[model samples]
Target: MHEMSITQGIIDICEQHAGGRRVLSLDVEIGELSSVVPDAVEFCFEACSRGTLLEGARLNILRIPGRGHCLDCGTDTPLTAAFGSCSRCGGYRVTIETGEEMRVREIEVDE
Candidate 1:
């Protein structure tokens, strides 16, 4: 699954920022529209982190809701998908403002 690759990327980022210190925990932000499975990422993290600096690191995921602005109605609305219709106007002309993000928010390292 893509979560395997995504987990590897997370490990890479943690290692890069760890600076030889062992990672104790990681705070990750995954948007609802990012298509990245949180469970899969958690499972992959255990697999990918084996024998690595992040072997026992705790993974905390923050799920962000999808949001967009309706161009036709000029109103901000919550979106469930990438191309969701505007809630206010029921129009397809919506500009997504967020919800396609996957980033490492914080990394806690051993002293």
Candidate 2:
């Protein structure tokens, strides 16, 4: 899975920022529309963190819901998919406002 690579990237980032310290915890935000599975990332984190600064680190995953703005209805609505119809107007002309994100929001390291 791509989460293996993604998890490695997260670890790389954490290690770079850790400044030779051991990571204690990490907070990551995964958006619904990002096409990345949180469970897969969590699973990969354990394997990828072996012998790294993130080893045994607590991984906190925050799931972000998708939201969109309807161009036809001029209303904001919840989106479950990337190309979901607007909930209020049932229109397909929806522009995504959020939920296309994947990022490491915070990291804590032992002093």
lDDT for 105 (candidate 1): 97
Listed in order, each prediction's TM-score against the native is 0.97, 0.96
- The C-alpha local distance difference test score for the whole of candidate 1 amounts to 0.94
Candidate 2, superposed: residue stretches over 4 Å from native: none
Which one wins on TM-score?
Answer: 1
lDDT tens per residue, model 2, 59-79: 999989999999998999999
lDDT of 1 by residue, 1-111 (tens): 789989999999999999999999999999998999999999999889999999999999999999999999899999999999999889999988889989999999999
- Alpha-carbon deviation at 32 in model 1, angstroms: 0.2
Worst 10 residues of 1 by lDDT: 88-97
Q: Measured by TM-score, how close is model 2 to the native structure?
A: 0.96
